[model samples]
Target: MDKIQHRTIFVNGINMHVAEAGAGPAVLFLHGFPELWYSWRHQMLALSSRGYRAIAPDLRGYGDTDAPPSSASYSAVHIVGDLVALLDALGLDRIFLVGHDWGAVIAWYLCLLRPDRIRALVNMSVVFHPRNPSRKPLESLRAAFGHDYYICRFQEPGEAEEEFARAGTARIIAKFLTSRRPGPLCVPKEVGFGGSPHTQIVLPSWLSEEDINYYATKFDQKGFTGGLNYYRAIDLTWELTAPWTGMQIKVPVKFIVGDEDLTYTTPGIKEYIHGGGFKRNVPFLQELVVMEGVGHFLNQEKPEETSAHIYDFIQRF
Candidate 1:
C-alpha cells in the first residue's frame, strides 16, 4: 500500500485526489459509491507490477477530493467532465478504463460522450442502459421496486445519513461491504437502516478489518452525503442525458457481474444481458462474465479475478 503514490490534480473546478502506481500504459480506475481510490489498491499494485500505470481517483465528493454542497453538482456531466479533465491534465490521449458500480455508470457515459479518449473498457457491477426519452430513471426504479427501495430511499436528503449515523459509520461500512443479499435493498421508514449491535458483519476472506477501518475513517471524515448525492441526482442525469437517447456505447468492452449482485438479480437484468439487448446497445461488447456466488462489490471481493479480467481484456486493445 505504501508503494502507491498519491497526488492531487486540479480538474473541472475541483481538486481530485489520485493514487498511481507503475510506469507503462495507463489504466484508469473508477470506483463505486461508499468507496474511494483505496478500493482499487490491490488492482493498482498488481497492474503496476505488471508494467502498467494504474490510476485511481477519489473523485469529487469522496475521500480527499472536494465535495460540492449540492446534489445538482454531482450530475453525470460534472463527474465525466472531471474525468476527461483529469485525463487531459495527465497528458493522456487514450487509455484503458475500468469502473465498478457508479464508476461503471460514468465510464459508460465517458465512452458515449468521448470514445476517442478510451482504448477499451472493462466495467463491473453496473450495465449501461441508454437514456429513456419517455420516463426518468428514478421513476422507473420506483415503479419497478417501491418507494422503500434503496435508491428511492436515498432520494430523500439527510434521511439515510441520519440512519447511517445511528448505525455508526464503521458498522454501516461493515454491513454494506459484507452484505450478500441479492435483491432490492429496501429501508422502510418504520424499519430504518440501522442494524442491531449484536448482528456483527463477518468480514469476507477478501476484506480485512484494516480495509474497513481505512474506508470507515475516510467516510468518518467526509461523510456519506457526497456519495449519496450520486443517487440523489439520478433523475437529473435522466433529464440531462436526453440528448444521448438511443446512442449506443461504441467501445470494445468486457462486462462482468456477480450472480448474487442485486443488479444481476434485478427484474429484467438477466434478460437484458442474455437477451441480446445489452449487446444491441453496446455493439462492441466483446465479453460477459457472471461469477457464481459473487455480490455487488465484485472488484473488492475478487480482486485477483477482477484484475485479471481487466488485464486480459484491456491488454487485447
Candidate 2:
C-alpha cells in the first residue's frame, strides 16, 4: 500500500486528492458512497503491476477532497466537471473508466456528458438508470419502495447523519462493508441507519480490522455528511439530466455484478439486464458477468477476481 503515490491537484475550483501508480495507459477509478480512493487500493496496485496507470480520486466530497456545503454542489454535473478538469490537469486526453455503486452512476453520466474522454468503461454494482422524463428519481423511488427505503430515508438532511453518529462510525462502516444481504436496504425511521443495535455484525474474510480502521478514521474526520450529500442530490441530478433522456451509452462497456448485490435483486432489475433493455440502451456493451454469492462490495469482497475482470476488459481496448 505504501507503494501507491498520493497528491492533491486543483481541479474544477476545488482541491482534489488523487492516488496513482504505474506509467502506462491511464485507468481512472471512481469509488461509491461511504468510500474513498482507498477503496480502490487493491486495483491500483494490481493494475499498475500489469503496466496500466491506475488513478483513483477522493472525489469532491470524500476523504481529503473538498466537500462543499450545498447539496447542489454534489450533482452529476459538478462531480463530472471535477473529473474532466482532473484529466486535463493530469495531461490525459482519454482513459479507461471504472466505477462501483454511486461511482458507477457517475461513470454512466461521464459517458453521457463526455464520451470523447473515455476509451472504454467497466462499471459495477449500479447499472445505467436511463432518465425518466415523466418523474423525478426520489418520487419514483418513494412510490416503488416507500419512505423506509434507504435512498428515500436519505432524502431528508441530517436525519441519516444523526443515525450514523448514534451507531458509531466504525460500526456503521463495518455494517456497510460486511453486509451480504441481497434485499433492498430499508432504514426505517424506527430502525435507523445502523439497524438493530443489539444485532451483532461479523466481519467478512475479505475485510480486515485494519481496513475498517482506515475507512473509519477518515469518516471519523470528515463525517458522513459529505458522503450522504450524494444521496441528497439524486432528484436534482434527474432534473439537470433531462437533456440525456433516451441517450445511449456509446462507449465499449463491460458490466459485472454480484448475484447477491442489492441493485441486482431490486425488482425488475433482472429483466432489465437480461431482457434486452440493458443491451438496447448500452449498444456497445461488450459483456455482463454475474458472480454468484458475491455481495454489493464486489471489488473489496473479491479483489483478485474484480481486478482480473477489469484488467481483461480494459486491456482489450
Candidate 3:
C-alpha cells in the first residue's frame, strides 16, 4: 500500500486524482458509488506484484477529483470522456479494464463507446443492461423495484444527502461496506437511510475501523451529492445512449459476481445472466464465475480470489 503512488492530472476539464502502481500492461480499475480508489487497494497491490500496472482513479466527482456542480455533468458520456482523456494524457492507447458496481456500469459503456481503447474487461457485480428504447432508466427501475428502491430514492438531489448527513458519514460507510444482505436496498422516505438511530451496525472482519474512517473522512469533506449525481443523470444518459440500444459488447470479457449480490438476485437478472440473454448481448464474454456466499463488495471481501480471477482471465489475452 505504501508503494502505490498518487498524482493529480487535468482530464476532461477537471483535475482528477489517480493512484497507480507497477509498470507493465495497464489495468484500469473503476470503483462504485460511495467508493474511492482505496477500494481497490488489495487488487492494486496484488496486480502490481504480478507485473501489471494498476490504475484506479478517484473518479470525477469522488475523493480528490473535482466535482462539477450539475447533475448533468455526471452522465456516462462525461465520465467516459474523462477516462479517454486520462488515457491520452498518460500515453496509454489501450488498457485492461476492471470495474465493480457503478464502475462495471461505466466499463460497459466504455466498451460500447470506445472499444478501440480497451484490450479486455473483467467486470463484477453489475451486468451490462442493454438500452430500452421505450422507457427511461429511472422509470423502468421505479416500475420494477418501486419508489422506495435505492436508485429511485437517489433520483432527487439533496434528499439522500440529508439522510446521509443525519446518519453520520462513518456509520453510512460502515453500513454500505459491511452489508451482506442480498435483497434490494430500499430506504423509505419515512424510515430514512439512517434506519432508526438505535439500529447498530457491526463491521465485518474484512472491514476495519481504519478503513471506515478513511472513507468517512472523505465523504465528510466532499458530501454525498457528487456520488449521487451519477444516479441523477440516469435518465439523461438513457436519452443520450439511444444509438447503442441493441449493440453487443465487442471486447473479450470475463464477469464475476457473488451469489448473494443484490444485483445477481434482481428480478429477471438471473435469467438475463443465464437464460442466454446475457451471452447473446455479450457475444465475446469469455467467462462467468459465481462465488458462493459472497456479497456485492466481492473485491474487498475476497481480495485474493478476485485478484486471481482478474489475473487468470487477463493474462490469456
Quote each prediction's TM-score: 0.98, 0.99, 0.99
Could you give candidate 3's per-residue lDDT for residues 1-317 as a string of tens digits?
A: 89899999999899999999999999999999889999999999999999999999998889999999999999999999999999999999999999999999999999999999999999999999889899888888888889999999998878899899888999888888877666678778998876777989888788899999999999888888889999999898898898888899999999999999988987788889999989999999999999999999999999999999999999987
lDDT (10s digit) by residue, model 1, range 1-317: 88899999999999999999999999999999889999999899989988899999998899999999899999998999999999999999998999998999999999999999999999998998989898888888889888999999898789899999988998888888777776778768776665676676788889899998999999999999999999999888888888888999999999999999988987889999999999999999999999998999988889899889888887776
Q: What is the C-alpha RMSD of each candidate to the true structure, in Å?
A: 1.0, 0.8, 0.8
After TM-score superposition, the amount by which residue 245's alpha carbon in candidate 2 deviates from its true location, in angstroms, is: 1.4
Write the residue-wise lDDT of candidate 2 on 1-317 in tens digits. Answer: 98799999999999999999998999999999899998999999999999999999998889999999888889998999999999999999999999999999999999999999999999999988799999998888889988898988887788888889999998999989877666677767887778788998889888888999999999988888878888999888998988889999999999999999999998999999999999999999999999999999999989999999999999988
In model 2, the runs with Cα more than 4 Å from the true position are none
Instruction: Tell me the spans in candidate 3 whose CA falls farther than 4 Å from its real position.
Output: none
Cα RMSD of predicted structure 2: 0.8
Which residue pairs overlap in candidate 3's backbone? none
lDDT of each: 0.91, 0.92, 0.93
Ranking by lDDT: 3, 2, 1
